[model samples]
Target chain A: MDFFFEGYLLSHGNVIGFIAGTLTTISFLPQVYYVYRSKKTTDISLSMYLLFFFGVLTWLVYGLILGSPPIIFFNAITLLLSGAVLLAKLIY
Target chain B: MDFFFEGYLLSHGNVIGFIAGTLTTISFLPQVYYVYRSKKTTDISLSMYLLFFFGVLTWLVYGLILGSPPIIFFNAITLLLSGAVLLAKLIY
Candidate 1:
């Protein structure tokens, strides 16, 4: 039953989650681009991104433990986005 | 079994998820404060938060339908955070 449910979700939940996750992940791009273009991150908080990165990292681990690809994949992308924001905050 | 699992999770996952969720949610506060403090959202993207909000809203709905408290709770808080960011982008 567990295996069956996992397989079912892999085909359905994984696809749906990925689609939703991709949209959510790309949504941060504009902010990243804005900061990159402007070279100003004063209004952005460094701690926020730093903390967010860790939180997403934890979620990634959680997803992995649960064998949930969507959670893992989404968090990985989110980690990158948050990491970029943190880097921009530092550089700009 | 489902009820037991839900109850078990309500005591465990809910608490952990809420802790993680609160941390993630508050992480956005700093950004919000910075935006409010500077009143300069020139670097912030309205579309990012708008899209994020909808993505999270979808997640919230997904969680509710699945009867997953963690997803619903975290997304709810996230919705507020992202909403604030969008509002700040518009106002500032």
Candidate 2:
């Protein structure tokens, strides 16, 4: 019974973790698409995003050092997408 | 030798984790302040933050279940701040 309960918890944890990571990473897509379509970012707070971009970079490093796959993967994608938005804000 | 090395690694890990968690959570402040000042979210990506807000919610739950202070603390603050931004977006 204890073994079964442990297995259930582990599986549940993995599923929830995966979903949380995936949602957080992909959530940046709409902003990317919106900025792409609008060609304007006048209202976006540059400071907040610049800090967030760097924060994500640190997270990526932290994940690598800790050998956490979910953390690494999510931060990698988030960095790319957030980086793109930052670039778009810069360019147009 | 092993004990010294382990202590260094553990302390280093804690410091970096604290920095990362703190920066990520606090980085949202500027955006919050900006929105408060401008009363505008015309360029803010609603869908993106909406998903992100929920993702942070899931993260909070995951953190609680896993007994991770950094995750729980960061996400809790993030949710409140992000939630405020969302509410502001709705109100104004």
Candidate 3:
């Protein structure tokens, strides 16, 4: 089972990772949209999201240094998504 | 500069990574609390968070298989935080 899973991930890992990362990262869309629609970020914490955004940036650098494709790829998407949410929170 | 950056990451990478990862992962707390307090996840997308949650799980597995400490640690924390948000979204 492990072997099969590994093989599946290895062959399709990049594609899956990309899709998953894209979808998950963009998941913030609904929240951002609602926040925009409502013009409220009352519940969102600025400091936390800022820190998290920076952390994601650092991780992206880490991935670049380590030459890890998935890390780099996922972090890139996550950064964008997280950043968008943070921006929306700040704006609204 | 690059060397210094690499060395910094090498020496304090794990620690910084942990802190960043923890902070970022837990940043969801405010959102969750807000959603809970307001009793609304109207802006939140269940499918997106669910998929992202699963994606995080898969990445955790990928990190484990790759034996990457940062990946493992960060993903572990992220899983918990994202999971919490997902649960809160579902419950409230």
Native-contact recovery for every candidate?
A: 0.45, 0.57, 0.34
lDDT by residue for model 3 (A1-92), tens: 27757776666655655665666666666666666677776556676578778878877876766678876887787788778778887777
Question: For all the models shown, what interface RMSD does each have?
Answer: 3.9, 1.6, 3.0
TM-scores for every candidate against the unseen true structure: 0.78, 0.87, 0.72
Provide the clash count, candidate 3.
0
lDDT of 2 by residue, A20-66 (tens): 88888898999999999999897788887888898888887678667
> In model 3 chain A, where is the ten-residue run with the lowest total lDDT?
A13-22
lDDT of 3 by residue, B1-92 (tens): 27647776766655755665666677776766666678776556677578778878877776666667876787787788778778877887
Q: Score residue B69 of candidate 2 by CA lDDT.
A: 84
lDDT per residue (tens digit) for residues B7-68 in model 2: 56555776766777777788789889989899998888888888989999989878866878
Over 4 Å off, model 2: A1-11, B1-11
- Clashing pairs for predicted structure model 2, backbone only: none
Model 3, CA-based lDDT: 0.71
Best by TM-score: 2
Give the local distance difference test score of model 1: 0.74
Model 1 chain A weakest lDDT span, ten residues long? A1-10
lDDT by residue for model 1 (A5-92), tens: 6555545653555556777888888888888888888767788888787778767656655567777788888889878888998887
RMSD of each: 7.9, 4.6, 3.4
